[model samples]
Target: MEIDYASHFSALAHPQRLSVLRMLLRRYPDAVPAGEVAQALNVKSNTLSAYLAALRAAGFVTQERDGTSLRYAASPAGLSALFDGFLRECCQGRPDLCRGIGGDLQTKKGTDMPFRVLFLCTGNSARSIFAECLLRAIGGDRFEVHSAGTRPASQLNPLAVRMLAEKGHETDGLRAKHMSEYQNDAKAGFDFVFTVCDRAANEECPAWPGQPISGHWSTPDPVAVHGTEAERMLAFQTAYGMLQNRISAFVSLPLETLDNLALQHAVDDIARKD
Candidate 1:
């Protein structure tokens, strides 16, 4: 029987497992300790162990025993197999088009020129909250970023706060603010307005003087999900990973070099990521 690479890849089909892959990919060759991985995903040690085991069995990951800790990294052959497998079978011999799409995915602007970004979603709880935190963490002082919601929730999602805090980013004073707060103001306003959930993107937005660039990220509602504590935490972490990938690319673009049209395209790309 031919080996179904799809089945192997399917092992990483869970939200948390894929998150672990991207997180490990970002830290490749560095071997992040298991404890850190657990913390990053807001998962318990046992839960993380199970997820890691699945990934290892799928050949997507490897572990190195570091004294009292087991650090994890992506397996070279595993990743290549994954890339080749996906590209060969699904891409329909147009790998170049796929590559082009990836290239156009999201490019970061140079660190020299910073842009103020506002992340919007229907509820200020989960997805939008994560996007705001991730962008600031990845961009540092390079970009001014904030988050808001159309129908603002009562608070920031606790899981989101905890997850970002584990990554060394402070979430103090990160309350859920309403989009209307910035909607009518004559302030300088956001250079980019991003809606991270489908509902927010579809709703009418408040007018701004400059009508800052806008885009829709369409992330799933993590707060509405029901599962075991570990499973729920994993959902938030997965969303974080997705937001981080886009933000990483966004922070690397040469925003100073791009004219309005290019910048608009760039922002659009950032908001369109899966």
Candidate 2:
């Protein structure tokens, strides 16, 4: 059945539903519990129930049962569909008028721009930074890499820096960056955007531009460890190790030639690596 875009849009027509989608995006690649969503929005459970139902119905969000509770994750396909459907109908033949908007959502495929990849997480401090440094060292000139946080820390995590330096990766110029910095960088949209959030963080992940191939590479939050100095260093080391493994596997793929669906599968497989 053809979706009634005009009517379905009513799902997000309200401010609360839109905010709910934005909140889920922060934890993209991970699901947020319904209760937590309510807490975060400061809405009563009953009210949030209506908001979530509307989003799910409109395809902005999806929910799954975990035990007896419900967890929600933002649906990328829904947003992509909304954009594509709207443009197809709205811009019909006048591609010139919507050219920039359409182009903004495209990957740098069939171009010599190298693979523009972004690593996202709650904080650009640890797992993401580790991935950035590893890819820079491993992928060489075949990839252009950057990392940013949904809620960036004021500075890069000291433990992360120390661990990277000890591993012989360049830690200079490494700092936490907000995802917003990339908004104005239109011409440099990413081909791949990975979320490295742990399972527990109630994070707000980035709304990646250009429909980049995305997957979740969940790593433990080393920054959350509060223990003896030795134990804390161990946490950073563990997180770094997982990202190193994942990025190393990622750099091995023949990414440039893979079709869109293949690229998506490749990244999803990389996320499952040890």
Candidate 3:
């Protein structure tokens, strides 16, 4: 069947619309909920609905009936069709023009190189940091863990730090950082990247290289909780517990035994599992 390349290009004309597509592609093979996409893009439900509809109409995105809610993901064929068409008709078989389209997606991990992993949250002060520490403690020699925020707070949250200390984790290396510190993974990206909060889940992630598998393990924002000191700490405790459970299961996975698609589904299922 002939694909309408013009319609697909036109649909991505709007910047936000284009962003939605890119973000979805980053989470390819794993669809995101419509509301989560809106939250990530900071768009009103109606506005995002229009953007998604255009993408959907152009066959650039796909919509699935996930229970009662709608989920969106980049269509597997949409961009590929565009590229094949561009090379055949526009670039006239210039393979160099297609170099930027795909990348080496293999995991080149070895005994000498630890399997790199990254965790993300918006503020970086709490959840992502918590995850970095947890994975570091649990993953041992097989993993090298990192965490960052989309919009990092100036310092690590005192409460988050205190709680970790109470649990006996060293606090010296826990600094708030932006994701860009690990940017341009086009040559070598993390083996896995998980967004632990809803905000970060929606936020546009870095262009991961080498087929980094991604998952959304949405934990409640401890900082967003506005309550008494004790109650607030409880939020941190709960978030920490949830993340601990998920990360334990994650590090326990037989990663070496699973292929990329299986690993993708495994990590994605980690979200729903806990």
Question: Whose lDDT is greatest here?
Answer: 3
RMSD of 3: 4.5
lDDT, candidate 1, 8-81, per-residue tens: 87877798888777766534344678887777668899988999999898888998897887889767568667
lDDT of 2 by residue, 150-177 (tens): 7888999887788788889888888998
Model 2: lDDT equals 0.78
For all candidates in order, the CA lDDT equals 0.72, 0.78, 0.82
Model 1: weakest 10-residue lDDT segment is 100-109
Residue-level lDDT of model 3, residues 1-274, one tens digit each, is 7767677788878999998997786565567898888877788999999999998888789999989999998885777677678777878877667554223224443345678899988899999999999998888888888999899999999999999999988789789998888886454678888888766766655467655877778788999899799999999999999999998998888887676767776787787765
Tell how far residue 213 is off in model 3, in angstroms.
2.0
Each prediction's TM-score against the native? 0.57, 0.73, 0.74
For candidate 2, the per-residue lDDT at 40 reads 73
- Output the better candidate (2/3) by TM-score: 3
TM-score quality measure for candidate 1: 0.57
Candidate 1: how many backbone clashes?
7
Can you tell me which runs of candidate 2 are displaced by over 4 Å?
2-6, 76-112, 149-154, 177-189, 198-216, 260-262, 268-274
